[model samples]
Structure formats: structure tokens, C-alpha cells
Target: MAYIRPLANGNFRADVRLKGITKNKTFSTEKLAQTWADSIERNIKAIPLMSSAQLLEITEADIESMGGEELFKQLGIDLFAIRHCAKLEAINALSKKELLQLTPQEIERMGGADLFIKAGKRIRYKTFREVCDEYLSRWGKKDYKGQMQRVDYWCQFFGDRIMTDIDIFDLREHVDDMIDAGDRATTINRKKAVLSSVYKFALSRGYVDENLVRSVVVDDDTKRRDRVLSDQERQRLIKACQVSHWDKLYLLVLMAMTTGARKGELMSLRWNDINFKDGTAFLGDTKNGTSRELYLALVVIAELKCHQEIGTGLIFPSLELPEQPMDFRAAWRNALKAANISDKDVLNTDGSVKLERFTFHCLRHGFCSALSDAGKEINQIAKLAGHKSIQTTMRYIHQGRDQKRQIVNELAQAFNL
Candidate 1:
């Protein structure tokens, strides 16, 4: 039963009282109050008639007939909860050993690992370590060593745990651990991405319910490295590289600055990859899994001609091991020291970088930033940098304060202000 009365505040009050159920609300008008009372009464009357069995059998049309999900929620009738309970009852009827004996195909036919999780049941799924190994075996060719190392680190903590058992909270704890260990945001995000990939692979094979790693949040604001090299710094760095102990350091640095190619891409270069006539280099195996052409400036081409290797071997092969890429970390650090562009001031007491430091990667940043400052189109910059996304190219572009002011001044002139 329902009733409506006019309140002292010039509003109408509705009261709906049914079998052990009571609801009341005030509305601005009597018609509104009556309508709300009728809705409540209908919802309250409809909930009791919906048993768990009926809830399990409820279709979209039946829910619409009952006034939709909001009405059921208003009457404290959780249709999902009722269905989940029915699922639990069905799962509970099956023995644990029987469930464990079911194959991945059978489990998938029973509504996937997601349904099992909702029904509070555990099935025999592969362990985290096993899934990691399987994932590596199938999809680790692109970055085998790096992905293997990351997987090993994850296995150290979650190797014994079932893939289905690892929830978002567990993943969050791992992220916190990485943060505590002084890992950079970019590094942490990369590790998280690897784990997320594993979870996605598991999800495809019906080993887990969801990719919980998608929920793990890391601070990404610090991921953008805006260390664009100044003209003076570039000059100094080039001069330093020219006099470095490593004879090939100057050419490597020159190509890195001119073409904005990654250290790996440059190091993996071969004699045949370069076309001297066109003054271009073909990067077949780029980071984005696509090939791109890098146009060489005349100076770069001249320098390349001087150090050109004859065969199809790597342009910058290792000195000791001809088949391997050179380990130039010491040479790179020495060049930085000679250029007086050291990160010593930004280093912590334990010699860890406390702030963004100028690295060889910064040369790429400088390349994009210089193009942006020169009024080049973003698409052109992204194409030259081989960035698959314009947003990524945007991160690399760090315009100087003078360039910003000049842009505004140009805008003012155009407006005749």
C-alpha cells in the first residue's frame, strides 16, 4: 500500500509500505510523489516473486518487464547476486577433483575462467611460472632477453601462484615493490606491460579470468624525458666524440644526432642497409616492428664514406667479437665527461641519477625538439622519428622558451595587435 500527504514545506511526501518493506520520499508535487510511491510499490511487489531459479532464467525482456535494473536495485533485489549464487550452487555440486580434471576446452565451455572465479571455484590452471615460460616460448622473439629477464623477476615473486589466483592487489603490491627499489616510471611501466601481456595471453587460453595488471597504476608524469641538447652542448659533445678513444664513437654520435635512430637500430646496421647514392639508411628492424628510411645529411654521408665497411657485416661491429655489437657504455660516459655534460650534480649520494640526465637517447629528443622549434609539422616530425603515434612524437618535442615567445609574437602580428 502507498499514501501521499502534503508536507508543511509545500512539498508532497510519499509513503510506500508493503509486506515487511517500507520506503518514503518527498517530492515537489503530489503527482511526483504518487508516481514515486507507485514505482516503489511495484518494485517491492516484483522482487519477492523473483526467486534464485527465476533470476537464473531471467532474460533481458523479463528484466525490462520488471522495470529494469534500477528498479531491482531499489527493491534490494540484486539479480546478478542471485544468478551468481545459482552458479555457485551448480559449481559446489561438482567435486574439486572433477573440476580439476576438466580440460581447458571443457572449462571454457562451462563459461570460462571468469565464470568459475565469480562462482568462487578454483580449477586446475597453469602456474604463473608455467604461463610465463609458455608466453616467452611463443611471443618473446621480438625482445627475448629483456622479456625473459622481466619474466624471471616476476616468477621470483609469483612463480608458485596460479595464474587465476593473482589478483589486481597482488599486481599493485609488485608495482609498489618496483617503486621502492628506485625503478624509473618508464622502466616500471615497461615491466607492467610485459606482465599485462602475459595475462592477456593467459586470458586467451582460458587460464585466467582477467588481466589484473591493467588496473595497476604507476606515476607516468616522470616518464617523459625532456633533455633536449642545446646547440653549444651538441657542438661540445660532437667535438668530444671526435677525440674519444673509441674511433667509431664520433660516427655513432653523429648518426644518432642526425637521423634520430635508436642506439639499437644504429648498432644493428649493416653495409647493405645504406644507399650512398640516395644518402639514406634502411632500418629493417625498428622498435615499432616496422621498417623506416633514415635520410643522411651530406656531412653524415661524408663521415660514413670515410668509415665504410666493405662486406654485408654490421657497420659497427664489436672490436673483440666481430659478430656482436660493441659495448660502448664506457666510451659514451667518457664522451659525456669530455663534453662537461655530466649528471654529477643530479646524482644521489649512492651514485644513482636523481633527475633526468643527458643520455644518447636525449639526442633523439633533441632531434624532435629542433624540428618542432623550426616550425615543422608534427606529422613530418613523427614520420622522420619513426614514431607510430603522434602523441609519442609530442613527448619528444620540448620547445625552448624563446621559441614559445616567438610563436606568440608571430600570432600577435598575424592578429595585427
Candidate 2:
């Protein structure tokens, strides 16, 4: 029996079960999955009889699939192609798309034509390290390289073994060891996240039957930091930033407090993005692909104009490389120290540097919190913070991968009952 199941993300899965062997295929459309299901079930049943009618159906589908319907029509065998399949028994299990590429003679050998493509999953016999290396080769960015370091343990742990041989138990044990090692919850999560991406690629390429990444869970019990700056803290921080008015970090902190934008988005901004006339800051290249036009506070506009005259490109250009955005870490810490903000790299009993109460992202939380404290509606806060429901939208557009980024909803944006 074959049946169609709808996935949460509006995709569909077709499952075929017969003779105790079950195969499942996913499709973006229910119709496509159903068509696949129908075809697979029909082929499975019609194997021995291999009716002429079925062969005609297969040939016609192949002609269409090959995207040569017009060419087939010109040959006039468009209708007569099926009659030619006299002794055809097996098609080498060539998919319709593959069958279409074959020369009529080659296809005739399979359709009666011997285009010999070994049918079945071509197992690459890859090790976890090999798979991770292939996956890592796709990205050359420093951030990607940094993330690879976080999850590189997986390559070492699963070393020299077939990647698919790694079951959910192996992943679970690794995650458990990470938890036991006093690693931060975020660190553990990020390691698992990178591993998940590697496996998703494996699943797509038929290297694995399933993405075991879905079964791994984050069990770290650390409480999340929901640090929103108090009115006093905001005032002191503003004064500290003002002390060094010429510093770019002052402007960066002020912008984050006012806009509630992601740090990466703010860092990527150019002077052109902040429009004084329109009173809007256009955020292009957001983590989510959707761009937003943020309503800039007039005070922010006036402050930005102070630097616009001096700068030609990035509003926060790097000191050394005008092409890149500034990395504001040192300046941020200086301002925090001047403001007497308690969040510091403090020495713990274990003598390790443990982060304290607050960080730069807390400025963004403060922005949303201030809005909420002023009694703004929940949806309005979501709108101002650019946190509209984008989960399903991305899935619809990007399909299986790169669509499942779990953007954390800022605590301040959540409504309190």
C-alpha cells in the first residue's frame, strides 16, 4: 500500500510498503508525492506482467521527462514508441529523467536499449571525517571554520568509520559527555547544530537513510540569561559612551539600543542604509533573507549625520580595512567598564573566566523591554523588533535545508500574562 502524509512545513511524504520492504520519498507537493507513490506502486506490482500498456506509460513519461516532447512529436513515434517495446523486461531502474537523456537506441536497449546505470543507492563508503571534510569544503568563511572547530570532536570520535554507521546512540553519548565537561549550554548546542547540518547533507546525497540529527536533544539545564538593562544602567551606559563621543562603539551601542536589530545586521550596515530624510534604516542581508525598513528615531538620525560627513562607505567601517565592518569588542568592553556594568569575564571558583550578568546583546533586549514597559502591544513589539513569524515562510521558500534556523525570540518581546 502507498499513502501520502503531509509534513509540518507544507511538504509531503509518500510511503510505499510491500513485501516487508518500505521506501519513503518526500515531495514539495502532495500531487508529486502521490504521483511518485502511484508510479512506484504500479512498477512494483506490474514487474512480472510488465504490460505493454505499462511500458507505453513508462516510455511516454520518459519522453516527456527528457523534456523532448516536441522532438518526440516530430519523429511521429510519439504515439508509436510503446509498440516498439517488444522484448523490454527491465529499465535498469532508470528514472524517467535519466531515461530521457539516453539516445533512442540506448533507451531502446533499456526500453528493449542497454544504457547500463547500476540502479540503487551508490554508497560512497565515506568516513565521518571524510563527509565532514567534504561538507566543510563548501564554505571558506572564517565563521564557518570557527564553527567547524566547535564540532570537530565528532570527526575525531566517529573517526574512520562509515558515516552512516554512526547511530543516534553515538550522538547522544557525545552530547552527554559535553554536558559532563562543564561546557556552556550554548557551546554544546552549537556543536550539535553543526553536526546536524553535516548529517542533513549526508541524507540529501543518499549517504544516510535518515538524518539522525533530529533525534539529538540539548539536555543542558542552565537557565537562560534575559538581561534587559535598567533605566539607571541605560543612563550610565549612555554617559560612558558620551565620554568617548568620537569612538565608533558609542554609536554602535546607541544604534543597538534604539533599533533592537541583530548585532550582525548592525555590523553589516553602511552609511547609505541609515536615511536621514526618510527616517528609515533599510536592513538588507538579514539573517532571515527578508529585508526590513526600520523607523529610525530622529535623535539617531541626527547622531548618524555627524559621522556621515566623514565616512564614505560603512557606517561602522573597520579601522584597518575600510571594506569591512568594525569589530566593536574592545570598545564595547571599555565602555562597559567606564559605565560600571557588572557583566565581566570574572574568575570563578574553578579559576576559569565566567561571564557575568550582561553583554552587548542586552542593549537590544533593553530596547524591546523599554517599548514593552511603555505598554506597547505584543504584535507591535514584534513588528518593531523585526520578529514577525518567519519560521514557516522560510521553509516554504528554501525547502529542506537552511530553512530551520531557530532564531531566539528576545525575552523582552515575549508577552507576560
Candidate 3:
């Protein structure tokens, strides 16, 4: 309802009151005052008179637009009390046999399983496998095979177990099992990280109350690798790659050794990423999500030119598929054998790695180490290796014994003592 009245100053005032909400305004003309009052009254009446249960559906913005919290209080609505009563109602409703028969979708529409749990209802939670499937489906990254493998291993271990049931104790047992099976600290930590990521996804979707993986501690006792190829080893490895069965293996190893690019980064490259005239390669996709440029050596550029394809497809496309990146694991192992770079110091009877041996990654280490040995600045090495920190670069920069001895001798000479 609204009332319009004339003021002594020849202006008009309008007052609108409805459902305990009141708003008043002054207008220059009686007609304007009447229009304003009518508008206000209509707007106030337009707001539906929601029940206490339905009031929970109103967002803060909706409340704000409808004259704020004070207006709701004036209308005999207490948000806090409503929420408390709604929780009780929801709990009581869940106890009904008819409500228990509701589909999962209906239950979610009413309020998620969390709501029923608060009501003291023991609901069937999603299995670990179901959670993994959902998590993988939502994964948007270009590379997820390694992550998928880790998730698969977890699903196999925790088969059919509900996510809420796998607590810190189960995670600890998993870690112990891995340790007993001779899994390295690094491997165990990697698996734990993957599980932690899954739990984080589950947490966001309200599948779990907490990430139990956070409570499980795994010791990372594995030492940082300082292995770098010697000059002779580098030569042998290059020659071995050159004569390998896979034609692309040579160029791949060369690019990896010279540019210090990770295996995935190089393998994902397309022909368009290279610039023959500038002797440069543009890496738009990298591990750190930062774009970088790799200056190609003349030898590498020459090899690339020779291997250049007709289209802008992958530089190292699979020979069979021609659309996917080539898998050169077997070829790489063969090259390592040919170069006499043993994968382990003392191989097991089953030919498994008992001790760490030289790997393709050592080529990257060799590149950084070589640059550091040549007196390059730490910052320069970091930029070349696309390392976000100089500390990471330092880990890869292992100087030979002779270089260390020479530096000591030079320091002593300078002291003249």
C-alpha cells in the first residue's frame, strides 16, 4: 500500500509499506510521487513470500536486493534459525523410508550426501574407482598418461573401497607396501602426490570431508642425482643414437642433450615450432607453463632440416600412427646398451635396476654441468635450462674433480700464502 501527500514546499512525498517493508521518497510533482509509490509497492509485492525451508535457497545477493537483512528480520524471518531448522528437517526427512528410496540425483537436489550425513544417516559413498573416473574426466591437461597410470595403481590397491573409508592408516599401509616392494622414496612420494591430487579434487566436489593424504607422511630419502655424462660418454651415446634402429632417435637425443629440454617437451614439438633461418625453437608449452626459446646448434639445425616434414605435424610423429608422438623407449634402451651406459651398477638376476645407472635425463644434466664448468653465470644456466630457480640449476651443475681442484689452487695462488 502507498500514500502520496503534498508538502508545504509545493513538492509531493510518497510512502510505500508492504509486508513489514517500508520505503519513502520525495518527488517534485504529485503524479511523480504517485508513480514512485506504485513502483515501490509493486516491487515489494513482487518478492515471493517464501517459506522458511525455501528461504534457504535465497542467495545473499537476492536478500540484499530485497532491502537487506533488516527487512527480512522485520518480515519475521531469521536466517540463522531457518538454517538450523532446515538441517533438522532434512535429517528427519532422511530417516523416512520413502525419502531413503530417493535416487542419488534427488538426494543431491535436496542437499548433498553431506547434508544427510549431518542428519545421522549412513549413506553409501562413492567408490574410489568412481571418484577416479570422475577426476580423470574433469582433467583438462594435454598430458595425463603418467597421472592416469598412478591413478590406476591406486584404484587397483583400494578397489571398491569408498573414498571416505580410506583414511591416513590405509595410506600409511600403502606407503609401507610400496617400501616393502623396493619402491624408492622418490617413487613413493610421486604416488602419494598423485593420491593427494585426487583427494584435492574430491574435496572440491564435497565427496570427502578432508584430504587424508595430507596426514600421511612419506620420507624422501632419495638423494638428488648429480650424474652427468663425461665427454667420451656423450660422444658414445650420440654415436649409438645415430646408428639406432629408430631414425628419429638420433635427432631426439641430440636436441635433448644440446637444448636441455625434457623428453615430453621435445616429443610434443611440431614442425612449425622450429625456425630454420634463426636457428631457434619456440616452446609454447613447457612444464612450468612459461613459453621459452631454445637456441639450436648448427648440427641440430642441419639434422632438423634433413628430417623436415611436408606439413606442420609433430616433428617426432609415430612411424605407424603418424598422428601421435613416437614411443622410443625400446630404442632408447638399445642405444644405452650400445653406448655401454649401464642402467644399473649391479643388475638383478631378472635384469632389473639394482643401482641407479646413466639415463637420457643425464644428458640434460651434462648440458647444464658443461655450461657451469665453462664459467657461465648461474642465472644464464637457469635461463637456458628453463629452470624457475637457480637452486634447481645448481643441482644439475656438478663440476668434475679436476675443476674443483683447479679452483682451489687458483684461490691459494691469489692468497700468495
Q: Which one wins on lDDT?
A: 1
Task: Evaluate all candidate structures by whole-model CA lDDT and list the values in order.
Answer: 0.83, 0.67, 0.82
Which of the two, 1 or 2, has more TM-score? Answer: 1
TM-score-better candidate, 2 vs 3: 3
After superposing candidate 2 on the true structure, give the runs of residues whose Cα lies further than 4 Å from its correct spot: 1-121, 129-161, 167-183, 220-223, 244-246, 309-312, 344-356, 390-417
Q: How far does residue 251 in candidate 3 sit from its true spot (Å)?
A: 1.0
What's the best-to-worst order under TM-score?
A: 1, 3, 2
Q: Which stretches of candidate 3 lie over 4 Å from their true place?
A: 1-153, 180-184, 201-210, 214-222, 347-355
- In angstroms, the error of model 1 at 148 is 4.3
Clashing pairs in 2: 108-113, 109-112, 109-113, 109-114, 110-113
Per-residue lDDT of model 1, residues 38-114, tens digit only: 87777677677776777778798977755577667766787766766655566678897778666666667666668
Give per-residue CA lDDT, model 3, range 1-417, as digits (tens): 899999999999998888777888899999988887776666566545676556888888977766667656665767755775765576575554545455566567767767777666765468889999999999887568867887999999885887766778888988998999998777889888989999999889877778998888877743456677777988898899999999989999999988999888898899989989999999998988789999999999999988897668999999899889998999999998999888755578998646557777777888899898999999999999999988888888989899999999999999995
Residues 232-277 of candidate 2 have per-residue lDDT tens digits of 8788888888776347666777788888888988888877777678
Candidate 1: worst-modelled 10 consecutive residues by lDDT: 221-230
Give per-model CA RMSD.
Answer: 22.5, 21.1, 13.1
lDDT of 2 at 57: 71
For model 2 the local lDDT of residue 361 reads 67
